[model samples]
Target chain A: MAAPESGDGNNGAARMVTLISSDNTRFEVEAAAASLSQTLQLTILDGGGGGGDGIPLPNVDSATLSKVLEYCIKHAPAAANGGAPNATAVDRAELERFDNEFVNIDQSVLYSLIMAAHNLEIEGLQSLVAKKVADMIKGKSPMEIRRTLGFPDPTPEEQAEMNAHMLEYGWAYE
Target chain B: MSGTIGVTLEQSRSRTAGPVLPENHVVSEILVRLSAKALLRCRAVCHSWHRRTSEAAFLLVHHRRQPSLPLVTFLAAASSSQSQHSHASLDTLDLRLPPLIGVGWTPLPRLADAALYLHGSSGECHILRCKRRRYGDHGLTTNAPAYHVLTIGSSAEPRRIELASNAPRASTWWFRCSERPGILLHGCLHWALHSSPEKLLMVFDTVTESFRSMPSPITGTQERTQLLEMDNTLAISWMDMCETTMRLWLLQDYETGVWTLSRRIIFPVTEMRSVLNVKWCRFYGTVVSQERYVLLHDSHSSYLFHCDGEGKLVRKFCWSGAVPRPAGHIGSQRASSGMSSSEGNMVLVRGDNHVSFKASRV
Candidate 1:
């Protein structure tokens, strides 16, 4: 129980920390869950974001912050157990399934998730999103990769250059 | 390639807290996660990407971040009117997974005679020479190789590692490593040497660059024994002559050489009662685990079964690459050696997490 130092050990709400997103939206979450982010862990550990004062995340929008909080909440228990090696296969499969579904989002939202994960220093979220993006790159031509990953369609000049590069470096193409 | 594609991207770009592929740090992080082939193709994306991904520093980081994938290589001896072993080639079976797909592979260095087999894992390569009567004349089979060469990517000269003089005659015994390469675990390469009355595992410490031996506690006249890295500890999977059953033994303590019978993997096979009820089946012995189930993949039989920790058959996949030579290979490699009917010498690199070979040549 991460009750704030200010709490007299009776206030039930003392276990929660409030986070303020860039859009000025306030989100109250368990200190254990919020501590999943290394960026927020210190503040949570120091009893900094309790009660009236909330940790400010100026770089994360409200939409992304909510998503990040959802992930942190889901994974906090496993992280608290120090990656619980004794976790049953069913539990691990459940977490893996959760991880697989978490990243199945719009490309735009995926990029946002990566940035949020990176900025908040969430290693699990960072790797999950990176793996998702890596899957899109495999077995696809450069043009197809750009198209699939939501990159702006290359102009004719850029397309010509890419073709030329492929021709020049045989290993770069299939 | 339409308005729908970059619509969200455009909206995200308007916000202050967003990243695109242009962000070198973010992009580099994603690039390093790609498979070896996909990473190569990424160079064609642009001149800048080629320049950035080609840097030695980036490669070092990629190698470190490299999710160890199972690499399967097939030796295709180019059929010629001359000699069978003279004109041959070895290339990796490029099957990237998590979805179990892929099409092509870049050919590895072409060996003139199919004498040397290269087994690489976690960036270290062990060049093993197959046992042949020809090597005995050169005083090779008589003496073991005493060098562990270290060559950092693209370095001209490789630093020769000094192996101890007591390094037993490992060439003939290690050649059997063709079926099972030396498993690298806890900063050492382990090879189970089943030579004589005494069976021991040869451990080559990467840090110390020296050799040490650990005697195995479990003994079997069965011949199929491989050192596996199970959950980070040393484990050996051994099957009897019947070939229908396998016993997995876990080393409880590295210091005391204690062994524990972990699980029994009963392969789903119909054993024929040969002559005097001495049951027999073709060879099938290699264990690779998934997150939930342990999949024992027989490289020779080309049949893979996903079994529980108790080794109960949960599901199975028929992966006999009986279709055709996988895409990107130069010629066909027929399965020979007077054993079972093998299409090619199928070898999967050790400790691969994303290895899921389905009904495709992928």
Candidate 2:
């Protein structure tokens, strides 16, 4: 495990905030980075999550919280530029590449990230995760989808329905 | 990242009979991103997915996002073991979408045998298939082959009604009814009662699974009238290429059945003609876009002319012998060129034993 840093004083005296995950793990992150979450933006605006009182995020676990923070930190610079209207194509492409890599984790961790992203009201993250999931299931056959999403073997009635569905839309079966 | 990267070991997709990934947020978010074909496949996953995708509000939202791309329908003949007589089936090749992407054809295997005419979309693809050894001399149905309406991917099979074999008047319809390809408009497949302008337009309403006649336009149909959908309205283009002029009429308001002569296109005789005495093949077809850009190509598909709504020539796009096989990829190239037209069109390139065409509303 990599040692956790006190954010390494990268910004000298920039405002830092602490977040407490559901498991009571405290994470210290830059205020601007944490503000990417609409849920946290307001509390951070009122000078909250400063000094000792960390924002309590009961819906997110430490792992998901760390993942979300990493994304926020990476994206905060671009967001601070007001949707980066002046940002070069290379910069946007770099961010896109990072984002593609960020979501390339295990399925369980990915689902948890989606839930955490949703709870935090991070619109970009939610859409990114949703698109990833959509791409995974697109063009897949019913049985393949059932297995991919971990759906159990269909009961007799469900099997009949599946059969009927296959009969009707067999052209779509890939 | 290591400490809880192991979280997946206990609760990945391997975990069955537990909390599934999708909530309402995730389902709608994910489902909407899927294509129409993918969504239909996704509906078979489970009851929750099936019901969620089936919701009317969700369907409307999903449909709005779908690209109204045109499809190339090719009539391919194949022998079916289910029936003694060889039959022809309507197969559509996707113009834009991937995998098939104009190159491959998605044949309707279920509706393969004896399927003659393909029409009526939106709710379901109503396939009109004929059965029994009851074909007239000119490859037309002498009487009825027992009209079996196969509603693809929707409700129960509509009751089969054999258009009473004893009815002799039905025999006159042998040319138009059984042979001529039906034009789809407003959820109905329409056929002219007679080739003459005086006859009423017969519509086989796919929704009600019944037949009804819509009165001819107030100005009456023009000679050699061909139905095409333009800007979401039914249009007829009367092309007597021999006279080097075409008349176009649009149904402004369908409820009132008002027909307005929109354009009178006069084709230039000097350009685009066959080597021998200006002979035009049946393979040549026309399509009008929502922007009113009219496209007509030669029988060889060698030249494509784009004309304005007023029948004035705008530009011309041509390619080498595109398809003695199946032609559709030209559409993408056509888009890249100027005049970005918006209606879906396909051309029916006649092959050895098959025929294909591009038209409005597929």
Candidate 3:
């Protein structure tokens, strides 16, 4: 569905685009925010996702798409200003606070976001989610990390292998 | 609503099993952000994880992502009770963490009755010890020297290598003289050997476990010469005792042994006049922190002299109070040997009988 007025004609008004989630949910967002995704940037530049023609992201679900859009919207302005060199300390601090809170989500949602971010080629989102995953895995043993990442318990052979590895790299545990 | 939206809205969501396993590339991207110690532990995660983490390409990526802090190892005088023959122990200082608490001192196998000579590069230390054996004219042994290399942190026991064949004949005094610490660059440990009429650079390649000699960048008799690594290149700073002039030379090309004169500084005779007033007073200058600082030690005291990239002295301060003295020997010999990493964050100091390690930033 298209908006009644074409905001593309006016330079003052922010350009808008429609994104279709994998679950077929339609969401409207500003073109600047959507452009943060390298994959969508080229399509948007080529006049795709204009008016009512929504860009379909087949790899991302509606919930994950919404979360990604939230990040893009918040980061777009600062990213446009080239990391906001002139931005006040409070503004930069607020953005950092927002980023810290954004990644604080359920493990399943975080995994979905990582997959979505990778598929969409969103550099910032990919790094952020990847860092979150790394933090969770930090200081955790192999088994603990496997469980944290939702991997199934090791089989007998795999358990034996892990035991051998632990014995060989015993200093790592220390 | 005007333009057509091509995709038809699905009323029901597609059911999926669970979170898909991330691709190896994605996993690598995440793992690269981890610290070296963390990644070492991560090798036990699984077969694929272990293989991926240990790959040379992945290790290079990890090193670039998280550059390792310099590790300093030196020889310290071992306690008398530890061994009846050997006099020294090995100590390691991990500059990546905080000082004092981060320093680890391990008592290695005894040096026996031999004199210990040490040089370290790339966090590995090569220690050479020699004992002279005397032989009488009638087939009785009196004094002949045998050299051995003490391998630290290796699985195998320390073995003896032929020192007479490997060592250059011109610099035989290198074993007896007190010299500056070795500068490690390009996988080779370099130390300046000053022997009266000739000066030679002793290069030990860690990969090949061999020793080679390169001509000194400066020829003729120079009072003091020190080897240092600057911007991944080998650099030498030598002071002419007669003229009290210091010159810094950088090895521009390693293959042809091409050296470019970087800087030359004339000592402020008026400022150092009081300190150098005595006839026997000898001043030793060593490049401590690459091109930033040079440690100058006189017979009685030591001072940290700040210098520019051009080797010009900017300012000087008495460093006796600031520099922590080595644990064992304090006043026996004035000659002190120390080396700093390329980044200058880590420093290892060796005195006559003691060794001290320090890090500026954690």
Top candidate on DockQ is 1
Q: C-alpha displacement of B191 in model 1, angstroms?
A: 1.0
Candidate lDDT scores, in order, read: 0.55, 0.56, 0.57
List model 1 lDDT by residue over B1-362, tens digit each.
Answer: 11112223322343333234434466778898876557766776655566667654565466445443332333222432332221111122223132222233334322211111112344432222232343466565554443434332323443455445565555534424333445556656666776434567777665555567787755443246655666667788777777777778888988888889887767555422221133443544445432223444433333334456565666543332321211111101101011111222212221221111111110
Model 2: residues with Cα > 4 Å off, grouped in runs: A1-14, B1-24, B71-362
lDDT of 3 by residue, A1-174 (tens): 222232435366678889999889998998888888999999998889988789998778788899999999888878777667988999899998998999999877887777778778899999998899999889988888766765556668878888886786464566
Runs off by more than 4 Å, candidate 3: A1-11, B1-23, B79-362
Ten-residue stretch with the least lDDT total in model 1 chain A: A1-10
Which candidate number maximizes TM-score?
1
Between candidates 1 and 2, the DockQ winner: 1
User: What's the ranking of the predictions by DockQ, best on top?
Assistant: 1, 2, 3
lDDT of 2 at B151: 46
**TM-score, ranked from best to worst:** 1, 3, 2
Model 1 accuracy (lDDT, Cα)? 0.55
Which ranking of candidates, highest lDDT first? 3, 2, 1
Candidate 2: lDDT over CA atoms?
0.56
